[model samples]
Target: SQKIEQNSEALNIQEGKTATLTCNYTNYSPAYLQWYRQDPGRGPVFLLLIRENEKEKRKERLKVTFDTTLKQSLFHITASQPADSATYLCALVSGLYGGATNKLIFGTGTLLAVQP
Candidate 1:
């Protein structure tokens, strides 16, 4: 079966720095990859998405890179701040079973805490 993997531990960072998050998967090749940010007691907000043919994508201080060959995705936040701290999750379309409907399979997510 296909599986998505992410760092189970929380990440701590100082203000005005960069925070990098990793997401890995196995037994599948996804066409699209998405990243989302979730704050405590709230729903996740969409961050970015990268297609399999795209190498890198960015928006403001956020950047995402997808490597289909390696079956991995990296999420980055530059000039991080306290407000930017949240749990980040990576999701991909489960093309294996739900090819027609394209169900999204999300990773467990990694928590990020930025100190002021």
Candidate 2:
């Protein structure tokens, strides 16, 4: 019954602006959350990992917030440029039982388009 959803539309914006994206979920209590960036035809690169107890996390130009009560997470990219354009993925991780794998479940990503 666990599910994740990100914006399906491509976000088009001018360079040097901030890009904000949303991720919503239902029916799951995750221990951790992660954000990743993926280019076309390539695997995702980890950007940030936040625990359920953490309210906010930041790294360089990126920031993320988790709300376990609402089952949602938000991703933000400040001072974004054309080079920052890509698909962003939000993932949720839960503790697995014995002999099981602790894996991150990914949402369908949001494509960002930065215009110069």
Candidate 3:
């Protein structure tokens, strides 16, 4: 079993600027690191997915980095917009249920508020 730290702080940033959010974990090694965006009362929308073997991954204005040794992953959004405001969730694969299956452990999530 692993513990996922919750970052309850809200991140406020100006539109057109870059917003960087961090995810830290302890007690388990995840096979893959994933990021998601969730709006109030809605399910999370998948964002970035990085493998443990990969150091970094990028798509358009979104980028993510995984450092297994540091037990952390970073999520970045370039030229952020007010529409990007939402709660960001950090998730990783776990075997808490056992049997070589992938179950995800999600963090409490950090809220990002992009102001125009």
lDDT of each: 0.93, 0.91, 0.92
How displaced is residue 27 in candidate 1, in Å? 0.7
Clashes of each: 0, 0, 0
Candidate 1 root-mean-square deviation in Å: 1.7
Span of ten consecutive residues with least summed lDDT in model 1: 94-103
Stretches of model 1 off by over 4 angstroms after superposition: 96-100
Which runs of model 2 end up more than 4 angstroms from their true locations? 94-100
Candidate 1 residue lDDT tens string, 32-97? 999999999999999999999999999999999999888999999999999998999999997565
lDDT of 2: 0.91
Off by over 4 Å in 3: 96-100
Clashes of 2: 0
lDDT tens digits by residue: candidate 3, 11-96: 99999999999999999888888999999999999998999999999999999999999999999999999999999999998775
Q: Give the C-alpha miss distance for residue 42 in model 2, angstroms.
A: 0.8
Best candidate according to lDDT: 1
Worst 10 residues of 3 by lDDT: 94-103
